[model samples]
Target: MTITSPSSEAPDWPQCAHEADGRRCRGRPVEPYAACLAHIGVDRRAGHLAALEPGAGLDLRGTPFTRDLLTELLAALTDPATGRHRLGPADFEEAEFSGDAQFARVDFTGDVSFDGAAFGGGAYFTGARFEADLGFVGATVARNVWLDGVECGGGVCFNKTRIDGELRLETGTITKSAVFRGLVVGGDATFSGIEFIEPAVFMETEINGTAWFDGALFRSDVRFDGARIAGKAWFDGAEFHHDARFDSATLSEDVSFNGTRFVEGAAFPGATIGGDVEFGGNEIGGDVTFRKATFQRTTVLGPLVFPRLLDLSDAEFQSAVTIEAAVGTLHCRRTRWSSTAALRLRHAEVDVSDAVLQFPVSIAGRSHPFVADGRELEVPELSDAPVRVASLRGADAAHLVLTDVDLTGCQFVETVHLDQLRLDGRCPLASPPPGLRRIGRRPVRWTRRRTLAEEHHWRAERQGADGWTRAPGNTDVWGPAALAPVYRQLRKALEDGKDEPGAADFYYGEMEMRRLDPDTPPGERALLALYWAASGYGLRATRALGWLLLAVVATVLAMMLWGLPQDDPEPVSTGTVTGSRVTMTTDKPDPVNPQGSYGSRLSSERFEKSLRVVINSVVFRSSGQELTTAGTYVEMASRVAEPALLGLAVLAVRSRVKR
Candidate 1:
């Protein structure tokens, strides 16, 4: 590539101003016009011919035609040497093509238009140059139309034009902008390595075949809003210096933005992609929005770099939504996700806020936790560096709304704003916060604690400002009314997302909420309290085990303090009415039994025996011994409460094991 500053020096010489493959030519001009020998031909004088001349075949093969006729110009040019016509015109409005139209290597120094014309054969404008605007409004090309390597100094409008065959504009350079609004392409339209210096508009255009835009560079904003493509759309390795929007565009086949870089962000809001949509290995400097977009098939989002916010608000996913990215931040408020399929987030480190997610999600085998600065989970080698996040708040989420969305696999590393959240259901929260710092008491001693989460938990669904104390959700103030639905949805989402362990956490949280709710019926609340106190809902078996141990300990202590029961002593051999003062009487005595005297007292031996009874009652077993009414009642209660608690412990263990 030769580096030449054509704009620095004065325009003295009229040379070949044509640029091929991004390099200007040094060919010397052969004419009074600013074109070289190759770019120039016999200068033909003609007024603005508004109508076609009376000829079946108009030949200007080597002649430079600079007329802006409103005639058919999309036809194949008649080979003057062979005197052959490619085809005739169709029954459309406007001028006839006299014959085939060809402008090979021709330099068009003036504006031109052949609006509403129809060509039966084809047209070739390969290596053509237009110093002014070029309009093909409402024209129809029945065959191939080659505009390969064309250069346009001004805008080129193809509005409402229809191309039946391939439309090639590879390596084309447009100085201004290209307008293809309402243009319809019946065949493939290739624009590989094309350059758009200004904003290009393709709004409301329809492409029946594949649309190739590989390596296309857009210096300014580009819009494909409301465009429809029935075939695959490839934008691999494209670069957009400004915002590139495809809002409301419909794609019937797969669409890829692989290796694309957007300096000003890209949007697909309200777009409906029928086939798989992929955005792998892209770089977004600004917000990449998918608001109100719908993906009927699988959508792969990964291996991308986002320096700014990524918004997916109000989007609907009919199938899987796999996100594997290094996003600076993510916003998905009111986004609807598929219940049958998954919303997988693998290895993503996102800073999310004001995100209302009630969709099933999976976060297993994911990268560390998703947390903003000040709320990062403490990985051994991880540092607490502040990362920029562009959400509603300057940093952290303000009011997140997870209304009717399922979020089963995600974790809450940041202190979430529970007050503003609206949770209809929740994912099982097995995820632990990275680390949190909180004020303990007196001198405001900030305590650092890491959440012991190995799974997902929806209550942990917070973004920014770490630690359970600082976390609005960790405040544990949401009443049963709010907590119930939140936990339910979270559990369902986690399950749907295939994060079972995470779902269990939300289940436990739900039961805990139930236990603490004062509005619950006293009986149900009592049971809930028992479950929570004994086992952390049927979700924490350790608590249940501890409750059993504590019960046993209490039973032992009671028996020790209240004294134990003893077996009846063997009767001593009574002497034959030895004396009446003591009223002692003895019967025949055996080795293990003897007739007792009328004198006895409670013994420590009996107290020791009573401890055995206590052990039996604690274990939901029984000691073969007669006891008082109170003791019987105590034994029965132990059989019911203690056994039930033990059962809960077993269930908790089973859940964990299964997970």
Candidate 2:
């Protein structure tokens, strides 16, 4: 490729300026208008007369013409006629632009060819309508080119054209096809609102600056193969009726397809993006492919309504990416994902069918937690660091393999399948599924303290006690019963503070006590009685009441008998009768007046009556005396051993007190 010099400094020049005067030329003209006026179509060339024509136009509407006719007509019109030149089927096969020229509003009837033409100035084709076809194959432009509203009945080809300025195709409607294959532009280009009625091609077109296609509508297929865009490209509201191809292209800046709708598939195989790429709020009715593309920064395709596939096979993102609320299949096959900053994936419904998360290894002093569904995760290995998770709320997984996974404070609600080989936490089961097996081959042991409710439940259910003596429950069929010996032993253990409520040691003692003897020791007999009374045992309560009453009465009577000597007289008192002055005395104290002093021996009747009254009031007519202390029981037991001696002692004290 020879490096062409700038147009102004080039030495060889064949140029003709636009005609100003309608008169003849001043110098030696190449072909004078006076001599060529008859041959140049006198009627159509009358309006724009005295102006040098561009070239003869061609027409190939219903006829097949040779290449020589197009060449001859172009040669004849190069002599600078001072009027507009028009060519139809007379010159359709071949045409060239060897010198700098202008052909505004020239018609072409067939496929007009300019295979190797070089233009130094702007190629102005504004409103130059072509009925059949047009071609500027491999044309080169050193400056700007304009094709504003230039309608073509068939495809207009510009396979490789280099334009330095803007190429305007705004409002142009092509009937059959359009091509700008391998066209290179040194400046910006505009194709805004251009309607391609047929298929359009911009295959391998390199734009150095912004390429505007804002509102361009493609009714058929469009191709952009191997193009390199150095600046931002805008496709703000474009609509593609068929597939759009941008295979092997490179975008050095941000590219946007905001609100663009693709009716068919869009492919971008082997493309590289250097900056942020956004496709916000676009709708793709077919599949969109970005296979093997490298994104250097953040890429966003948020809030898109995709009706088909979104493939990102073999694509690498050096930074982060987010594809939020995309309602379609998301395939991220063998892609390297990371972030220079933080990467967040909140509130996105991800459908990972066969995705491989090629998680990058963490550098020194960095943290990375790998989290993906086991079925969706395609990595053959795993990380060794701790995985910090906020919560795993209702995630479904048949197999969860975490090799050396550190979960410091993780809570498990529903039943988690136990691992066959485990380490660090004491799981109750020994073996489970293969996927649940831990990396290490040791048992994981963990001890947890039970809450109050948990302790009560386990004790009443697992270890049966009196507290659980209600109607048998569903679990009580295999559970232990409330036995007295077990209750006593458990209470003793609890009082000694040697056992916690739910410890295994406490339960072991209770189980052992269930086989012990039922007869309690005499010191604990009172405790047994109190227990029966407190629990409202009616039969046991009656028995305990009778024994307690006998014990207390025996204790009080014995104490009173011991207080008197072996010859002690019973207490007595003397009083005067109301009618006669007489001292009344008895051998026993009056039951109602036992606190008075004894006076003298009285009649046998009085003495006998006093003794009977004392006996009835103190012993026979009363319920029983109250036992206030342990000594009272001991005294009563001793009195029961010798009841005859106690009766004699009481009678002697009564006789002595009366005398």
Best by TM-score: 1
Residues 484-572, model 1: lDDT tens digits: 65566546655654656656766766665566566889999987776566666677777788887777666544443332322333556
Give the runs in model 1 whose Cα sits over 4 Å from its true position: 1-95, 115-121, 140-142, 294-342, 348-477, 484-511, 521-584, 587-659
lDDT of 1 at 465: 26
For candidate 1, what is the total of clashing residue pairs? 36
Residue 553's lDDT in candidate 1: 60
In model 1, state the lDDT of residue 119: 63
- Listed per model in order, the count of residue pairs whose N, CA or C atoms clash below 3 Å is 36, 25
Tens digit per residue, CA lDDT, model 2, 1-659: 22232233312222222233442211111243322222234453353233424433332211111233333444444444534345553321222233334556566554565544555455677766677777766666666777787777877777777777767777777888888888888888889888888888887788988888888999999988788888888888899989888888888778778778888968888888877666655657788888888787656543344545666667777765554323334455454554432222222122222223333221111133222222221112222222222111222112222222222222222212211111212212111112322224533221222112222333345444323222224322211233333233333433343333212322332332232224445555565445333321222233334544554455444333331222224557677777767777765532231222333223344344333333433345432322223424444444453233334334333322432
lDDT of each: 0.58, 0.48
The lowest-lDDT stretch of 10 consecutive residues in candidate 1 is 446-455
